[model samples]
Target: MRCLWDCWPMRLTIKSGIAALLLSTGLFGAASAAPAQVADMPPAGEGPRGTSQAVLGAERYDAIGYAVPYDGGANPGAISAAHPTLPIGSFAEVTAIDSGKTILVVIAEQGLATPDRIIALSPGALQLLGRPEAAALGVRVRRVNPLGADQQALRDGRPASARIDAPAVLLAALRKRLPAPPRSVSTAMPRPPRASNAAVNLGAGAGYPVPGRAAAPSVRPATSRQGTGFFVQVAALSNGQRASDLANSLAGSVMAGGGLYRVRLGPFPDQASADRARADAVQRGFGDARIIHE
Candidate 1:
């Protein structure tokens, strides 16, 4: 009877061992079927990192004054412009200082080809910024939304040099002191002055061309310089032929300047005279006509 009781204890011990073994096997299988606990957890450093967080923030430059009459091919109305260094087709937001208005524009062609200006916005973009027909304005520009690659490039890249800002009051004052540029003259030779009796003259019948009329009075150089007179700019074109054509069509003189060939009415003596010419230009379909100084 003692031996049977001992065997019963052994049998119980065997059963317990088997149950524990089966439980361990089931746990091992589950562990093998599923990923490790740490593997299931979020990636390392993910707790502090987020999609909104940037490894390096975007760079911003200080104020730059942009010039007007931007030219970007056939689509003059497009809210686009050109920059000297910014990648073409990239997007940027420009904020006007005085009006506090902002505009989104795409970099289109090459800029004004000058270091004096940063980005040149199209007329449409300028109008959207709430300042239409402004010759120049102080503005801040920065990349707003960019492509993934562009963002990466920008983050890794160095910021561009800030453009030199022109002082408003100083520039205005200097402009007031500037002298008007001389008008363009045709290549046609001026009529020779009539020879006086005291001057040596070729004998007549030498096929020499005689003066058609009285000699023109000589223009003496002014002792004191005059200020630059006002002018009305009708059009600014890049194509020399097109500009010449427009100038020929217009009644006034043409001036080539500001990166694009310009068609202007006159170097009128005063703003009042320029206003009258501008009115005439507006009547002839030049709606963007504006007064200009040399």
Candidate 2:
């Protein structure tokens, strides 16, 4: 069976003025701001190491506050970001304007110095907040206690405060700042069932196991390959022809036989080869090149 994959193009606009100020004034400088005293920190053993409270509000830096460069496809599971001052791995709360939902994300990458925004979230962060279309949004950087604990609390229905030092206060503040969820899009694709353990082990062993004859492998139904590499299309094209044209310009071989024109990297027999190709493409200016396996 064949599947049509759509890559979404992301347009990033950086606020250059803010980038200059952050570099020159050192907005994150410890000397400019008093070092957070132990008393001001969360209670001991409350949150994960390096966690702190954060707040989300509107503030203008340079021209654009956030930049979403299409540096390959963004993963929806990772909590990465680009920030001007907050160190990588720092956590923050991102709220959407359309949805009243809020998600905590971690800083993953360094943002462009051109845009003067406080922080730029990873593509995964935008998806979690249900605002993948939004170019900019309000964010609050609070001092979180434990880094990943609050995320777990949100997922498991436990109170974030219970795992951290400040529960009541932070929850109350977040409730007011959260954004509403985005409208759902209709697609023919159906979600796949969860994976099973026996099947998992067989794949993990790669058609070989212990020296002795293992139990006969189960005859599981064949599954569709999810391409060797994955990429999110960032451009908005009205038709496959336009997509094909763009793909050709990028020197990407087109796979348009299936109605969807896919700009692909290779007939790579394995994922590692595709990954290397993707890296090479990025260096050559096709920063959006992604791996999709046949």
Candidate 3:
């Protein structure tokens, strides 16, 4: 998911120091807000803006290198990418020639220098790319102006045809399956539900009455902290042979998750350690070993 910052300029002045500290610690600002009702949000594959056309090329560098860290969640909808030099938030299109599939992913974070690759695919994106197995798959990258009608559709919550070909059909199905949008809580005149006197006593007590006796203590919800480490994402595959070939090449360094075989280097405690692992992976022929948060 994208990090949605409050546009209030005054808040920046009030908390510049705090913001800097949070950034240094890898905790993103604005993520502290209660989680949004993302259920209504479209799936990651719901549009073409998320899809791009990339031209495949030979691995550019012999060794992989790490890029700077990104603070956003591992959400495919956000237009972020890991590039050798492109500023954060820059937009690009990636196309897989083998399968004729394309996706537009933004530079959300920095990426490895080796495999001398274009963009790293998000987990959702990797699935869309057909899951190639080679240590590195060919990809092409080009800058795109992110202000077209397609982009607008994404920003405005309209379904993009590139991602959701049958929006109406899908929406209809979802409406049938999901409950209506929840009503907001009213602050005034709150009233308790109608219940018997015994039931009301149970509600007022520390533990509610169960059929047998007291109810168990309520457990707090789990805290949702972001992953601390990073992994490389290989998106797009032409065919099973390509996927198998890539998988075999990086068999030692790769692990499968969410259906994609991710090539990772470290649970490094710091960026320096991660960088070293990335460099070593590139030297060992895993040219596109990018550091991604786990």
Residue 59, model 1, lDDT? 52
RMSD values, in order shown: 23.7, 24.0, 29.9
- Clash number for each model: 1, 45, 33
lDDT of 2: 0.39
TM-score of each: 0.32, 0.29, 0.29
- lDDT of candidate 1 at residue 175, scale 0 to 100: 39
lDDT for each of the candidates? 0.48, 0.39, 0.38
- Give the number of the best model, judged by TM-score: 1
Query: 32-119, model 3: which lDDT tens digit per residue?
Result: 7557674543453332334432223322221121111121234544433455544444455554433435555555444333333334
The alpha-carbon lDDT assigned to residue 238 of candidate 3 equals 16
Clash pairs, candidate 1, are 180-228
* Model 1: residues with Cα > 4 Å off, grouped in runs: 1-63, 113-115, 146-294
TM value for model 2: 0.29
Off by over 4 Å in 3: 1-73, 76-80, 132-135, 152-294
> Per-residue alpha-carbon lDDT of model 1 for 1-294, expressed as tens digits?
556545978889888888889788786367668875643222222221112122235453323454344533335567676565555445565656554455556655443443334566666666666665555555555555544544443233322212223245433433333233212212242322322211111111111011111222222232222236787877644344554456657755434322334556666888899899989988988776778766
